[model samples]
Target: MEIAQNYLDSIRFEFERYKTMGDATFAQLDDSDILWRYNDLDNSISQIVKHLSGNMLSRWTNFLTEDGEKPWRHRDTEFEDPFTTKAAMIAAWEKGWQCLFEALSLVNPDNFDTVIKIRNEDHTLVAAFNRQLAHYAGHVGQIVLMGKMIKGEKWVSLSIPKGQSEAFNTKKFNK
Candidate 1:
């Protein structure tokens, strides 16, 4: 039981970390930057946020009682950018994370092993948490990378800056 509680606590922390990364990336980007893609085949940050939001709403709503892939979810349509403004896109991102956190809050040791379904496939609660964590982390990484590319030399480092890892380690070790 303690293990289950600890796992939930850690998962929440991880999810918040990724969300903070995404938020920092967005802060560095302009409105147009969010819509930029390498090409027609690539997804813009806005589209990615839309997709993530849609997935979260579907998967987390009634998570213990319903399929993660909700019937109303139009997966392909998520790729289309419905948000005309950066604020709208960010709002959707917040909504998605809110749904995820709210659902996670309902989970306890008693239901830690509950079987959840994604697209009619069963997933243990921890498995579902891991799956979403990986997915969100990958997308957040993409957002940060693209923000860096768009900002170029102006990009502020979210972590230890390039070639400064040794300096960071020195500072940490000395503390």
Candidate 2:
């Protein structure tokens, strides 16, 4: 039981970390920056965000009780950008994370052993968590990388800045 509780706690932390990383990346970009893509085939930050939000809404709503992939979700359509500005993109991002965190908060030791379904496929709760974590983390990486590219030398590092690892580790060791 303690292990289940700990796992839930850690998973929540991981989700929040990913969300924070994306938020930090967004903070450095302008409105037009969010919509920039390398090519027509590449997805812009807005497109990635829309897809993430749609996936979160479908997968987290009534999560354990219903299929994670809701019938109403048009996965392809998520690539379409409805956001014209950074604020709109941020709103969607926050709403999606809200749904995810709310659903996660409901998971406890009692239900941790149950299986959840996504697209009619069975998944242990741990598997579901790992799945979403990987998906979101990948998108967050894209957001950060693109934001860096858009900002060039002006981009601020979310983690340790380049060439500062020695200083970072020294501070850590001293602590």
Candidate 3:
């Protein structure tokens, strides 16, 4: 039981950290940057956020009682950029994280072993959480990379600023 609590706490921290990275990346980008794509084959940052939110809403709502793939989810359309403003997309992003965090809070040790389904496939609650963590983290990485590309020399580092790693580690070990 204690282990379950520890794991849940750790997962929440990791998710929040990634969310901060994405937010920081978003702060540096303009409207055009969010919708920019390298080519027709690539998705822009806005499209990635849309896809993430769609997945979050689908997987987290009625998470324990229903299939993760909600019947009403328009998965194909998530690849399209719907918002021209960053604020609108930020709201959507917050809503998605809210759903995920709320659902995660509901899963305690007593329910941690409960089986859930994504597209009719079985997964334990922790397994589902882990799967989403990996998926979301990958998308967040794309968001960061895209922001850096768009901002060019103006981009701020979200973690361990360039050429300072040795100092960072020295401070850490000294503490």
Candidate 4:
């Protein structure tokens, strides 16, 4: 079966939007803020980035040929403070996303029905892709929310700002 180009394009666009959200959120924070944990029970933004990066690389690389939970992936380590600087965290984030995009580019409509495994559970390619997309979006939302809380009023709105819906709609309607 031929995969529609529009479907693949939509997925790619959504993934890129999530990446932009993470980048914008990171931009609003200082290095210390990125590394600051609320308490012993919570993860810092840096830790979240590390975990996201690790997950992207593990799940996307060789996605169809091997299990998503790679044997070499130290998942627990992702929660630890492996990065001391915001720059390091950003680099890891970029690296992981790069791997994910590369893997996604290799997928086509023909493979949409192919079986893939995530931790030994089998799913069709389409199902697996949707599952991971949801997972990444969830994490990206967390990163953005945490950044917003940390930045408070100084935080730049990633989308339409509060109380501006009317103005935004007006502009859209005018267009």
The alpha-carbon lDDT assigned to residue 57 of candidate 2 equals 98
The digit string of per-residue lDDT tens for model 1 on 1-175 reads 9999999999999999999999999999878999999898999999999999998999999999999999999999999855768899999999999999999999999989899899999999999999999999999899898889889999999999989999999999999
Candidates ranked, most accurate by TM-score first: 2, 1, 3, 4
TM-score of each: 0.97, 0.97, 0.96, 0.94
Task: State the C-alpha lDDT per candidate.
Answer: 0.94, 0.94, 0.92, 0.88
Q: Check candidate 4 and list the clashing pairs.
A: 3-109
Which candidate gets the maximum TM-score versus the true structure? 2
Model 4: runs farther than 4 Å from truth? 1-3
Q: Supply the TM-score for candidate 1.
A: 0.97
- Give the winner by lDDT: 2 or 3: 2
Give one digit per residue, the lDDT tens place, for model 2 in 23-116. Answer: 9999998899999999989999999999999999999999989999999999999997557799999999999999999999899999999999
Candidate achieving the largest lDDT: 2
After superposing candidate 3, which stretches have Cα over 4 Å from the reference? none
> Which pairs of residues collide in candidate 1?
none
| True lDDT of residue 32, candidate 1 | 90
TM-score pick, better of 3 and 4: 3
Candidate 3 per-residue lDDT over residues 52-132, each given as its tens digit = 999999999999999999999999999975677788888889999999999989989898889999999999888899999
